[model samples]
Target: MSVAGVGEFGLIDRVTARLTYGSTVLLGPGDDAAVVAAPDARVVATTDVLVEGRHFRRDWSGAHDIGRRAAAANLADVVAMGADPTALLVALCVPTDVATDWVEELADGLGTEAAGVGASVVGGDMSASPTLTIAVTALGDLGGRAPVTRAGARPGDLVALAGRTGYAAAGFTVLSRGFRTPRLLVEAYRRPEVPYPAGPQAAGLGATAMIDVSDGLLADLGHVAKASGVAVDLTRDAFEVPPQMRDAAQALGVDPYAWLLAGGDDHALAATFPPATELPPGWRPIGRVAAGSGVTVDGRPFEGPAGWDHFR
Candidate 1:
């Protein structure tokens, strides 16, 4: 049934029924305001908005996947700061004509993904809008570890990455072209595989700087480069096209490196560590830090747009 039939409270009931509250939740859904624990005395919070046609399309993704993607967007940022995410407060703005069940599935996706990391959806509000929009705020605890920031990278540091890159961009390219793409490529866009433990683990292992690959690898790294004031020259030879996108790229006549360098939404963790420090498992070296400034592709200047632009 459409949300217009059930009304707001009824729809909220349906969504809340499916949630499984986590340990960090002192009070959960149905409360006027949720009370979540801040065991580390400092809370790490991040928020993101996913707008229809901008961040996602109804034709390309299911409600469940969209919900997961929305939650991941903020949760990944908290994790990148070297924290364990604990709870989420979501705000949903939906068109009256959208099915109520679709919203419920979205909530299920959010709750399920949050639960995976011992977190829960604590509370949220719904509103009517002309289009579908989801805004999620993720809260986390540092567990006494220093929050990793985009700064701290310096000369003589090793650049490393964990999790997949380029796949999401390739997937986006396929979807945008309205052409048939492989299942793996499609799923990469629909459901990103975020390496949950890697962020906190990297911090524990003394990572000097870190950021998630959201706006595109090069563009996002430029943040670290600017923040740390260190020149970052990424080694092109270090990246090997993943098996999932190789054949698809061949068929599409797209360069894999373009996606790796320019694609966003992959959500992989790129970090810098002191030279000679053994990288935490699952992370491999990709580049190095220099005493100079800005970002480089194989030691040369990158001349194009680094990644996706919201206004352009």
Candidate 2:
């Protein structure tokens, strides 16, 4: 069938029917907004919009990659607040020529990532557009615990993180170097497997402040620093990338630190803990909080652009 023959709703229906809405969905798709049972006192909500050619390229990422990334990015925000993701709503716009299988792959990707974070896609919408765009809203529950916001960090708090840094950036570097995606870096770029459990773990360990390293390490940590009215110092010397990244950076003639410190899309967890608090497994101590504002690297001002912005 031709693009003109397969309309937007027709294509959407084909993909949507395959999705299985979870039991918690009070009002699933075909609504203004899907209603979910918020048993927890607070519902952690986050939304992210990924534009084709900006957030992703069809040439670089598969439909599944786009879906996974779209879901993971928003889900990471809920995790940053130390909340457990419960449900997700996705809205997509695609060109008329887009294939039905591509949409299914996107849904599969979304499902894969959502399931990884203990959530499911409850609702979505589809529309015809010139270029593809995906907007995802993730809802989470705090389980009666207060959110660990960026503003909660206090002076003397020890800074720690869960998950690797610079992998996505390194992957991008590899791509820019005309190299086909290597296994590690390709997976880093195609589908960032965020350490979803780390946020709740930090909260359970009494984390003072938390933020997802979606942007560069320094930039996202700077959010916590500014919000908490504390200074964050990262020991870059202690921040080591896997040997694969080292080789990629060397091949690209780019400083791995640029990717580690300023590259975004890592989706790592950055949190501040009290001096007495025990570090969570899979986390490493990287810095400490001081009675000041802004983020520093090795006790010095980190000289670089802030981070990702839709409109720079």
Candidate 3:
């Protein structure tokens, strides 16, 4: 049935009925505002919005996947600040003609992704609009740790990465070309395997700086470089190109490195640590922070667009 048939309150009741919240959520849906526990006294909050045609295509992704993507984008931002996600507030703008089941599936996707990090979808709002837009706000607690920022890297810091990159971009290319045999790549694009825990783990290991790689590695790292006033030199040989990526690249006649360097939305965590510190599990050194400015690949400027830019 369409959302218009269900009406607003009825649709909200249906979507929120079966949700499970974490202990941090003192209060959930059905209130004007949610009251979440903030034991650490300070909250880290981040928000991201996904527009239907601009951020996703209904033909390429399901409602659930779209919800997951929207949640991951904001959740990754929270973790990048060295905090544990606690609650999520999702707001939706959908046409009345949209299916009620589709909206429910989207809510399920958001709740599931939030729960993966022990967080809860506490509350949200629904509105009538010409386009479908999902905007998510995620709140996190630092557990008394210092919030990691992009400005802490010093010269000689080791640049490390946690989680897969390039796969989502490769998958995007595959889908764009109308073939989906490379399930791994396509799935990566649909649902990024974000290393949620790696953020706090890196913080514990004395990570100097950190960021969620939503835009390509180089593009995001450029933010780090500019913020920290240091040059980042990445070694080409340090990254291990997956066999699937190589195969996909050959079939499409494209360079996998382009995907690795310029693609975004993989949501991998990139962090910097002191040179002598022992690296955490799931993180590997891919480059170093050095004296100077900007980012480079093998000590030279990257030859293509660094990463995704919403405008030009």
Which candidate number would show the highest lDDT if scored against the true structure?
A: 3
Clashes of each: 0, 0, 0
TM-score of 2: 0.93
Q: Cα RMSD to native, each candidate?
A: 1.9, 2.5, 1.7
Q: Any runs in candidate 2 off by more than 4 Å, and if so which?
A: 1-4, 303-312
Q: Residue 177's C-alpha lDDT in candidate 1?
A: 77
**TM-score on alpha carbons, each prediction:** 0.96, 0.93, 0.97
Better of 1 and 2 by TM-score: 1
Q: Over the stretch 1-312, how does candidate 2's per-residue lDDT look in tens digits?
A: 523467766765766676766655787666677788778867899999999988898888899998999999999999989899989988888887877788888999898888776688988877888988999999999988789999999899899989877888778667656777567997798788799999888888899999998877888888898899889888877788778887876776666777788787879999999988888578899998998888888888865442222111
Candidate 1 backbone overlaps, count = 0
User: What is model 1's C-alpha RMSD?
Assistant: 1.9
TM-score top scorer: 3
Q: 22-123, model 1: which lDDT tens digit per residue?
A: 789999888679999998999999999999999999999999999998888888998899899999999999999999989999999998889888999999
State the lDDT of candidate 3 residue by residue for 45-105, as single tens digits: 9989999877898888998898888999999999999999999998899999999999999
lDDT of each: 0.88, 0.83, 0.91
Clashing pairs in 1: none
